[model samples]
Target: MKRGRLALGIIGALALGLGGSVVALRAGAGETDRAELEKRWADAPSRFVTVDGVRMHVREEGPANGPVVVLLHGSIVNLHEWDDVVPLLADKYRVVRFDWSPYGLTGPDPSGFYSTPRSAQLMDGLMKALGHDKFAMVATSNGANVGLEFNRAYPGHVTAMAFSMLPLERPSQTRKVDWRLKWMLEAHKAVLPNWRHREFWRLMLEDTTPPEFTPTDRMVDQITEMNNLPGALDRQAQYIQANVRAFQSSDVGAVAEAVRVPVLLQWCSFDDVISQSADASVKRFTNTKVDVINYPDLGHFPMWEKPEKFTRDLRNWLDRQPPAPAG
Candidate 1:
């Protein structure tokens, strides 16, 4: 009995030691990968346009003659989140997408302009630099916050606006993580071993596809690769910690009240991040016939989940708006 107890103690210590080593190794790998990704971004194709003494990374696509539409991605996601949406809209409109300062390939802002108001100012400068005096805006999540602020500051430039999966009010409590993080952390329990979460992946692919089709493996890889960006998770965590109040305190009511431009508020009924109650608040601010489209099957990333439907709906909405006044 004494010998057996001693062996058990030894085994426990060994197990603890092994676990500690594994964690240390993982920490080291994470640091190395993050550095590599930052270096890669150094050579990435980006235009540094001066905005309020800060140079912001910007990218534009499609015809110079086309109407301008600025696409703003969510907190962690860069301009690439709109990759699928941009091509569909590009034929009709010049699509402008950029990593907001301090996230994704854009990296951190050297000028310390990281808040929503500062971001809006940078965006305004970006549009001006692009020679677009007036343009439409489309935003998701935190990007929506910046978009609304930009509209408030420069309503003359924003002709129409579209918002997706955006929170209406500040969360009542702190420490609440975004829906995407919750899903990933939960899914990691089963996903990390195989480096995939089949159910989550399947759902993502199916959501983006048309009603009749399944998404190919390549499509799944394309998305998973984006999510696997080094420091992507860290950057998102930091942004949330630093700016949760901004998201919560976002004056949806104020923006809605002041915005005279056409607006489309697209909310996914099933989204866990931005609650449905938040969507209801938009009506309080605007009677401009707020075009609210609720998708019963979609999640937070609706553009990826239902790309075709999302694009079609967006295009249809844009088509209804009269052309902007020529400068």
Candidate 2:
């Protein structure tokens, strides 16, 4: 009975501490010396490719001749998010991962513009520049939003879609916002500075990751290093500020409807913010297969949370789908 009480007390204390942290709202860190940051965060399989007029950071692995799978990571995360998952599919499928502007090693957008449409264009052009006319795509978080645009803009080029943390471009679920949600949204905006902080993101990962999976010290350190990439914080802030009013209802649904290839959506059952997108996209998608798998424990990034399980499930799902077009 004492132990149970102690556990409850600890939980309550943690809740209060997190709540206080959110309320405090700290400023994000500025970039350290460029040379130092570049040396620390630039990992293997790195290359620079000129896409359209913009230079992007690319990481290519697996057999060059194999069917290609392009990966788009979540906001505030770099291509390394796919590090574990890459090898799982690399031998059988060529994997291409890149750092989109305003994040990762790619740095800022030269045009000072960032939106789903622009990112979609970048993805399509990047694949083409890599000599891949047709490929499958996997994106997470905001990356999924860009993937929707990619499919909408260049349907012929994408053979399959897999999106985790997919954002649905649909009408607000409610016409009225209660004080709590309104307050929460406002508070989120108020914490804009911390959004650029690596420690904040690290704490988020710890709070969000399921108990079954433990994020190693190395994992957290690597993620923090990426967050501290030179100029990334400023670029990300600028992009978000520019895109405050970006999406309209049906914008994402229309993209989903236009997708003519196999698509898989993986969501966590408890994730109310993004899991609903699976249902939203499934209803809108008509031309090709749209499948959803809900994990009992995983959060937004199931691929990172349960890499092996996610890879196995993905491989099985891909096997069941119509194979990609020949190289």
Candidate 3:
């Protein structure tokens, strides 16, 4: 047999084995109750607000009268990603962070609707519930996409936006995959709802960060427990698919050009996943005052990896901006 054929045979065997294992694991998996998760994750300053019928888990810090700043975490992660930066911003700004459904203690949305547009709507509703009319936004990864969508839908509501690891183009569109192997991806998504292995979460974290940045055991536990929540896996899969559809159907250039507020682009040098979009993102923000800063050593989650530096840089940039009228 040809070497290529042999390699293909091995790949086929591995795929079959993995798929079978996933199905078996899924059969035995059970969902954890939201009430139980709340006990473990929710604490001081944590509150739930009904936004568009979905209960949102949110935290507010700093002075109530201070300038408002909202923090948006990336996909598959909760608001805790900014645990280190919240206090720093809270010193002068009324910093707010929240967990989107299916990702944090917020649990899953009953509607199962997940997309950037929907997230933007939820955000607007959440802000109104909190009595915030306008605010600055610090968003990462998919959250940045939500921020952009929010700004486009409600112009002048966002005074400024700072984005890191912004994916101007969705990965599915950029990384072309063979149609023959697509089912493997689908099977993985199907299996996620039943998956509850901490090692798997640990591996994912390690793969995204530098070798030196070992994800703590607590981090692994948190992620595992969150994903294992009842209905979270299914909702997360739907969210991923919805996001891809939104990106595919919408014009990214139009969205970026629509942004009129001051912008900050914190591009990471080592995040091979989305770094390619960095230069393109800056150029797309032709209508706004965009400040580009490259972190030569950072990976995907720069804020999580170096909160102090991230917060300091953000503060300095924000201080330089002339105060704009609140919405």
Candidate 4:
């Protein structure tokens, strides 16, 4: 009886403390209006289009008649991640970048689904909307998997693909989360209010990138602002909570095997998130010609760390590929 009373008292105290902290912090931490964010972040080429009931924030540049090149950013980031590389490509190929649901100005998906197949479908819909029946793809991390899935589901639409930091784990591997840790994670999500944590991102960037890479203030600020938007944090939390099932069931090896088009693996040796080596990933694509170029000094985000060199290397690869089928 005494122990039960003690536990109840502790729970009450924690609830009161969290509530007080939430009230104190929520003044400046409230969700930023979506329109206000659009005005600030959306540039000249930016447009919102409805795809599968989700209004996607997309940007297009270069000549309309130029061959299309779609850029997909990794998880936790939006289309702005390609800002550095866009200018270099825009004068030549038609450059396209967009924010996937639950990220950037796109916010949460109404359908509440974020599987790789769904992402592939959305990409096809977006490209179709833009009159691109086929295009090349350049993607990183989670986005790279989306590209692989796109090639599998839509096939032939992706004439060529260049990827960096592809997180392709096998279907047989499973992550077992400790029940105590899972409970704590749930508690943390429940008790804490949704808000931007710039310090968390700063630490993450510092830990993930090499010493040569310094995350600029603008990069931190933009990410912070994006996460602070309404429903963004909740959506991200929901996605993270589903990771054990999602990662385990992913058949990336099968997807890679289905690729008949050429592939470029832009590997970052210092990447802390994915495997530092690309040998395993290269072997997975048994059917296709997989060309590799290693960035020995860079980490997860080579484009942000070395934009000019990244663009130059990517442009060279794209130049070598045969032209896509006419739309």
Q: CA lDDT, every prediction?
A: 0.66, 0.71, 0.77, 0.79
Ranking by lDDT: 4, 3, 2, 1
lDDT of 3 by residue, 29-87 (tens): 54556787777777778889988688899999988888888899988788888888888
Instruction: Report model 4's TM-score to 2 decimal places.
Output: 0.85
Ranking by TM-score: 4, 3, 2, 1
The candidate scoring highest on lDDT is 4
The residue pairs found clashing in candidate 1 are: 170-248, 207-305, 208-305
Give TM per candidate. 0.72, 0.78, 0.84, 0.85
lDDT (Cα) of model 1 = 0.66
Q: Evaluate residue 221 in candidate 3 and report its C-alpha lDDT on the 0 to 100 scale.
A: 70
Cα lDDT of model 1 by residue, 239-260, tens digit: 5655666655555546666678
Better of 1 and 3 by TM-score: 3
- TM-score of candidate 3 against the unseen true structure: 0.84
Q: Name the weakest run of 10 consecutive residues (lDDT summed) in model 3.
A: 172-181
Instruction: Give the per-residue lDDT digits (tens) of candidate 4, residues 1-327.
Output: 999999999999999997887776565445677888898899787999999898989999987777889999988788988989999988878888998666788746778976667777888898889889888899998788788888888877888999987887722223333455445445546654476457656655666678878899878877878888877877876755454466666554567888888999999887756742589888888898999998889877888999999999999999889866443
Least well predicted 10-residue stretch by lDDT in candidate 1: 189-198
Candidate 2, after superposition: displacement of residue 212 in Å?
A: 4.1
Give each model's clash number.
3, 0, 0, 0
lDDT of 2 by residue, 174-200 (tens): 433345545544564566433445445
